[model samples]
Target: MKSSILTRPFYYLWTTQTTANAADVLYIMALTVLVLNRTDSLVSAALMPLMRSGAQMLSGLIAPLLMNRFKLPALLLLSQTGQCILFLCLALYLQLNDNNSSLVLVFTLVFIMSFLDGWTVPARNALVPRLVAHEQGLLKANGLISVSDQVVQFAGWGLSGLIVAFLGPGHTLLLTVILYGLAAVFTLGVKEPPDVESVRRHTAEDNSAAPSSKWHTLTEGWKMIWQMSRLRLLTFMDIIDMLGGSVWVGAFTLAFVQVALGKGEEWWGFINGAYFAGTVGGGLLVLTLARAIGNRYLAAMLIGMAGYGILTALYAINTRPIIALILVLLMGPFAELSIVNRRTLIQRSVAKETLPKVLSAQASLLNLVFCISLLVMASLAEWFGIVNLYLLAAGLTLLALGVGLIGRRTFHNAADPGAGD
Candidate 1:
């Protein structure tokens, strides 16, 4: 028989994530349109993502406390259920108020819903190793998840416009509520292994022997990252890569298309579409090569980072629109290789009980870094020009590659699951 990881429970998890992700895209699109219509301000529309990110960052910071109290599946269920209920309220409010809906109340609901949703990723990741019977299963599992996410991203944006166009923002939000409800239902099927639960229980007991303060619970993940050598290096490289990666955000990418490629919004759509296509392809590639990559996770990550950096540099200088599209499409697989392997490494680098807290900390740091990068890169683009801005991003990626190179031995040792621990 095949492993349980490939069975019903994992499928439930996958379906829950897929539906929830779809709901996320739909709600964001609907909200942005609603805000734009109501406030007639681009700045107000933009504030949606900013507010979501801020709330999620705050959520990640405090997630450890909840992780300690609830099991991973339970935490996931809570998040999905909470989002569903909040979205229902939002939908009802929109329906009742019609033209007079308050943006303040809308944004407040968005923030709280986002805060509840923040636990999903960390909890899901921590559950993966528990769900899998073999260590190598992680590569295939992560690849599967990545592929689904990329597919959702590729199709979601395109479809959401039509959805909102037909149903209007209010009705579209009602659709989103349905998706969230489906996700919560599927989340109920995810179950942890008995052995894993026992280990977590023992770990909790050990920790409870000491009087754990709130401050310590909050900082536990941060402290783990600081103390673990491999984790520290991986996180540093992740920070640099994230800083560099911010160039691909919608506004910056649009700016690049206009300034460097001399193209318009149509090309912007093509570019985004191509990048997601590439990521889907990359995810498939990782799935095909899961066994081989699992044996040399560190090497694959380094190569991926290096290739992405090189492609980014070439992309920055090229003036041809066709070539720019190709470069970004090619950048996808390399980006996925690095991202999936690094995530797998992080999962394997710590004990089962500690993984959620560590991941929460890392997620918090990356979210904070990404927000800052957006601002810093926007300023650099303003000061140095669009072409030079991408070049700077490429330089940051190479710097990340350098960090990985410096810690090669440590990463090599960590290639085996649980080796670093």
Candidate 2:
């Protein structure tokens, strides 16, 4: 079973990707703490996420062009190596500078690194089918990827504060530099498929039409997603869900820890870790039932969405810290079930050649929504209070569930035709 899904090259690619992701979480968490400590201004600390999101928005828009032109392996190499260099520079800046003037440089590096990340997500997803080599294998591979990513996230976020406290910000930055450098090294071993040009040239006689104009080619991804009813609906669901999903972000959680829980800052870390730990459990459940999930994915996703809304609502009303933690922990499995199913559907539904573009468009669209949602939600939280904000989030999730029901047939059609119900 393992041999069917975990080929050698895929193993290397998975390892490289997971390591990069862990380092990303660790770096961002470290940077937030560092900035808050250095400036002692919440506004200054907030700018980092804003900068990263802005960079991601641009990156998502442009990544399709790069993916179409360059080989995936080359893009992966460049992104990893670029981040490694940026971290090294940030580490050096921290070591050398003694004033707030260096904050600009730190933000600049973060923006650039995040921009590089936008390209990496779509490319990685597009490349997965190639590495795994079969339709059945894709499900298992995605399950593994989901579980492993949650594990990495849990470890990275859980340990980051401790590591930072022990090593200090500069040393923490240096450690990330090392992690990203190692990620680059492993990425080098990924076996990229033949370039698109080579394949086209080999079949030139059979497909001799001139290529489409650059504008058409570049916009094709968006067009495909828009034209496909299922994809369009799924994309819409994602954007809507994120409106509520924004609350799970650290910014709001930090506020919740302070205002709602009446706990110290460290509870922020605990809540975040608990959420990821629950996702890990949910992913494991999905992995074990991957085949069954493939059959009823649409129902599973809708149920998951509904559960998230209900659970988040429950969490918001609870005054007890332990009870709140339990509610957040319960929230994770539902979110994971929906997310994993959604990703698998995309991979299965889209054509391989256009998958990168579709995925990139989706990422760009989602990131844009996230940036706006974070701002809007944060404002609403301030106006209405966190509990009311969560209730609003629950309302949005229920709305998404309604949309999911209306669009159920789209995903129902997506189930494996070969498999018996």
Candidate 3:
């Protein structure tokens, strides 16, 4: 028999999140194209991610303060509603302007929509364990969510071009607004679990530790990640991943597909689609073998980190399209496995109440690293070439793996409740 936990609220959460994910990708694609068409400047196109990342960094830093006041469901609803309104306004502005496509207005809307999105990411992640209810099932639940998220991205990005060509950017944005509205409505159906005592205990501890202050509250998540051992390790891994992840960004990947692969733009699209497909397959593998993996969360992460690095290194040297595509496809499962296990590890280690705070802090740190890496990677790419940049990314991942191996004993002890104490 199926668990009741997965039947109603969990089901609703999945549906709502998947729908929002699709809208998120669609609008991002639409806006990127819009920026290209309007400005015809690489710098303006680059600014798109910078604006969104900046908003995400700010939102993540402050989300914990809001989390203290609002429940996850309510926060999610607000995010969806906020994005819906922003998209509607942008669409209206475009329609009335007869598609003049003001760069300032477009970038501003992107920032706002992404800022709202920042809250939903951590809130939804923290809500997953609560919905699943069983610690042992967390890996399974995470795998399912990861699979759905990748699948949604694949479908959304795949169809986005066709949608924009037929309906135009304004109409495509209206479609996004509708999707956001549906997400908000579905979020209303989410039934949060009862209050966790650990949450209350931690809140009390924080209150007693420091006088009530906005700055203290805002920094609480950062303090928690730093003070907690398991969290610290995971956050470090996350930073490395973010730095390496920049290579997969639109700017870098597009350059690679053009220069290294020496293939048409269609190959660029195909390679991306293949990676997502591999990720989906990986998630399914995790779902089936999670039990067999047992408590070896650290091992799973190490293997993933190592596998991804090795594959990336191989990809950097190979000039053949078939070889590069295979490497890209093979990297997907390892990447997904690493991502899912590390997240599950955090969910298992952190107290239920504090998960959002930890996740938000982690998100903030990722954006900070990603933003910096973008600048660094771009500079390095320009100076050393794209293949060398890929090699550098692999080296960073392997560095993370080396750190993990050196700290292997620490992983075994990191999760102890008294370790932080």
Candidate 4:
């Protein structure tokens, strides 16, 4: 079981990844609170998710070029380094500012943090299979990684709030830099496989022969989506679900705390962190009860998320801080199940070399949809009230439920799910 957890390469990858992700969770929650506290504006909070989505979009644009041009290790180093600088800048800006009028600077820092994050993820994800290259090890590695992610997210959210409460958001940002630095150190020693250069050369040969443009290569992914009906359908459903049902997160929850619930503004970090607590709880459930219960891939995701949606709607209606936190805790597991299954689906379905591109595309789609959803959800929260806005999400979740039922073909992928991760 220990070896199962530590399978050499994947274990090392997890060491770095867990630290990086923990920092991200904490940074995002803290950043959200800091921005809102300073500006007293909900729009400033949208900057958090917007910057996040922007990072994904930026990654989608540059992933292919970076993978082709530079070694993954070098790119990873540069990405982390850039993020470190951005984080340091953010920390300094916060310390120096006596006047709270520097809202734009906060937004700029969010974008920079997200941009570096985007550049980092592709190299990170693609590197995972390299560490645990065996076939059977795929599931174990994925499960272990999922577990690690939950652990990090669990700590990040829970501890960030506590830190913010005691030490201030500046200390929180400073801690984020330390975590990123640790990730960078762990990443420094990862040995690329011998075949990596040959793979690069082979790609160069193919590119030279036809001079196939990047846009052509990328849009090709879009075209292939339709050829694989199930992939296309799942992708479509993801986009729609994000835009329709998934929009009530990030700032909406903050808005709910301030506007509808009349909770004081200082607890935004705590509120967001509560949602991550739910994620950890949900993830543990997936790891434990999966075999004994509704264990199928698509079914598990649909059922889990729908259950979460109902709870979210209930939280929206209740408006009590305690009830909201309880429902958020329930939401954690469902969120993790959805994340893990979706990644599993992508890995199983897409070809090995194409995985990066496809994953980048998936990230792009999710980002685009989330951005739109944030905008709509923000406006709707203003107009309809956060409770009604959340209720609307519940209604849309029913639609996602229908789509999942219709696309039951995904459930069948476990038997032959291909080279994803």
Candidate 5:
């Protein structure tokens, strides 16, 4: 099974993605350190992430135009290569200037790099189905990717500080450049199957049937999601989930530790570590049971969503720090189950040519929702207290689960031909 599923193309894709993800973590850390060192203000440091998110959101909004024109491997390569060049330039600029005045230039480079990176996720996801030899491999492939992502997240944050402390931010940025370059090289080795040509032909035919315009291209994915009942529900659930998930951002988690658990930063770190640990476990579990879960994706997704919601609600009400840690740890597997299945469903639900656009539209919407959700969650925490804010998040998750329950039949029927068109 492993031999069949882990084809050469898939191996290249996985390695490319994993290397790029690690580079992302290093880049963010190095940039944050640079910003803080130059500006000496927490607010200034925070702007790095804000700008990255804003740039990525804008990029996602316009990604369909490029996706329509370029092949997935080319897009992935372009994104990585562009980021590598920009990051190298940024590092060189900081090295040459050695002054705080270069901060503006630094931010501009970061935003541009992030804009390019916005193409990576959707392109990567769209390419996965093409790279894998069999439909059954999708689950295992996604699970493997998820596991790597979680490991990166877990180790990246924990070690980035130490890496930066040891190597300094400038050197860290240089290291990221190397990673990006390697990723670009790996991307060059990824070869999509011949069926992708047929997908492109079909897309070309559809394009010829209609009068194409920038507005049509931009809104094409949105229209598809709205018209397709299955996609519509899935996207709606995603929005709700993002809104709820925002409560787990660093600031809110810190506040929760201080207010509810009466713990310090260490506990906050512990909870996060536990959550990532759980996610890794969950990914392995899914990988082991890929065939069984793959057969009943919707059912598994619903169960996962239900478990996550119930655990979230319980965690919100709990005051014990240890229990809170355990609850979040438990939430990991459910989160992974739902996330992996939903992503797999999205990849399988749409036509091959259409998947990138659909994913781009969904990514844009989720990014916007997450940005707004951060502000909303912050305000709620200030007004009603952190506990209530979490309760509200739990409520949102449950509401999303309710939507899944209501759409169970629609999701199942989505397997039919043209059901999600």
Candidate 6:
């Protein structure tokens, strides 16, 4: 049965976000194949994720101030509309002479598209609390969205590959624009609270905090992070792990087909689809584990994530395509656990008034790490090869294990309502 709290806007947001995320994967894939075909340069190869990270960093830098006045829904809508325009331009370029074929142009388009996309995500994340009506509602709401996101990706990627296979990149880019337009329309179903509370909060936060000058507002999240040690630590750990994960993202499907198992591009789609499918199962287990054991979330996160790390390492070097695919599918069992615990920890630790800014800061920081990681990983992989990438990642995973030991206990006690008090 549908709860009234899970209203029409909620579903619309979920579906539209699904469409948005799916389109992003497709766009990346399209750009990847196009670049590979045009230049075959590994530096160019790394440009896609680097561009995304750069875009995200730019947004992350200014989000605290920008979000200070603009409510979440408006920010999200603006982002969606902005992406549509960026894609429309790219589509037109493709329809014109030689698709420009300039790596600079390609890099710029990805940066623009991704930059616009980053604006909305923090807003959407900030708005989650408003959508849900209670404490338990928080976990349930997050869990449902996680599950939906994974499910959407599982199917969306397969469909994206088919669209690319038959229609070609030009048509795929155009279709992405169309999907963004649809997302924009659906976004209209969302009603943002008029900028009252947001404005007041910003004023109060600024005035109460201290005298500040130039970009101080922009980097306020750093202040918040310093003040909140546990959060700072958690965000730092995420950055390190996310750096390792950058190669994981940049090369996963591509590696699965080309290097790991020697399957073709089409089989690569199957590999990603299976892994995302596992994430759906993973998200469900996250909810189950949280409910079954309240503060024991850390143990689940450690075991699940350590297991996921092992599986990813195996997938990196394994020769058997079937074995690799099966291992990846089973990866959800742990990935979900780690993610749910992370979110829960953040939610419990951060104040409601500052949640949006805090989230933005953390997201931006991780993404910055992601960009550097992508650059390093691509260079190293090109030089040292893919097998070594896994060995390096395994070492980072062990580092995360140490983090789990020290930080796990922190999150359990960090959520005291009176801590900041």
Model 3, position 188, has a per-residue lDDT of 88
TM-score of each: 0.95, 0.91, 0.94, 0.81, 0.94, 0.86
Compose the digit string of candidate 1's lDDT tens values, residues 1-421. 6556465778788999999999999999999999988889976887787788778888999999888767888889999888989999999999999899888999999999989987788888888777776787888998999999999999999999999999999899999989999999999899988887787777666557765566787798999899888889999999988987778878889999999999999999999999999999999999999977655778888888899889999999999999989998999999899899888888888888788999999888888898788778878888889999999999999999998888777755645346632
Q: What does candidate 3's lDDT look like per residue over 1-421, in tens digits?
A: 6665354787789899999998988888788778777778888888988889989989998898888766788889999999999999998898888556577877888888889888788988898888886667778888889999988877878799899888888889999999999999999889776665346456756665776666776787788888876678778877876787899987788788888888888888888888888888888888888898776777887898889899999988888888888888898899888889888888877777878888898888899899999999999899999988988999999988887777666556745541321
- Order the numbered candidates by lDDT, best leading: 1, 5, 3, 2, 6, 4
Clashes of each: 0, 0, 0, 6, 0, 0
Q: Which has the better TM-score: candidate 2, or candidate 5?
A: 5
**lDDT (Cα atoms) of all candidates against the true structure:** 0.87, 0.80, 0.83, 0.69, 0.86, 0.72
Ten residues in a row with the worst lDDT in model 4?
Answer: 412-421
Writing each residue's lDDT as its tens digit, candidate 5 over 1-421 gives 3558668988899999999999999988888887778778977876776687788899999999888766788889999999999988877777777664478778888889989998789888988888887888988999999999999999998898899999888889889999999999999998877789667656656665775576788899999999987889899999998998888877788889999999999999999899999999889888988977756777788888889989988988899999998999999999999999888888878877788899999988888888788777767787899999888888888899899888877865745433432
Off by over 4 Å in 2: 1-3, 193-212, 412-421
Stronger candidate by lDDT (3 vs 5):
5
Which of the numbered candidates is closest to the native, going by highest TM-score?
1
Range of the 10 consecutive residues with the lowest summed lDDT in candidate 3: 412-421
Candidates sorted on TM-score, descending: 1, 5, 3, 2, 6, 4
lDDT of 4 by residue, 102-131 (tens): 767777777766776775665666666656
lDDT of 6 by residue, 178-293 (tens): 98888888887776434546665667566557646436666666788777766776676676677677655736458647876777876776677778889998888766655564
Which is better, 2 or 4, measured by TM-score? 2
Clashing pairs in 2: none
Question: Which residue runs of candidate 1 sit more than 4 Å off their true CA positions?
Answer: 1-5, 203-213, 413-417
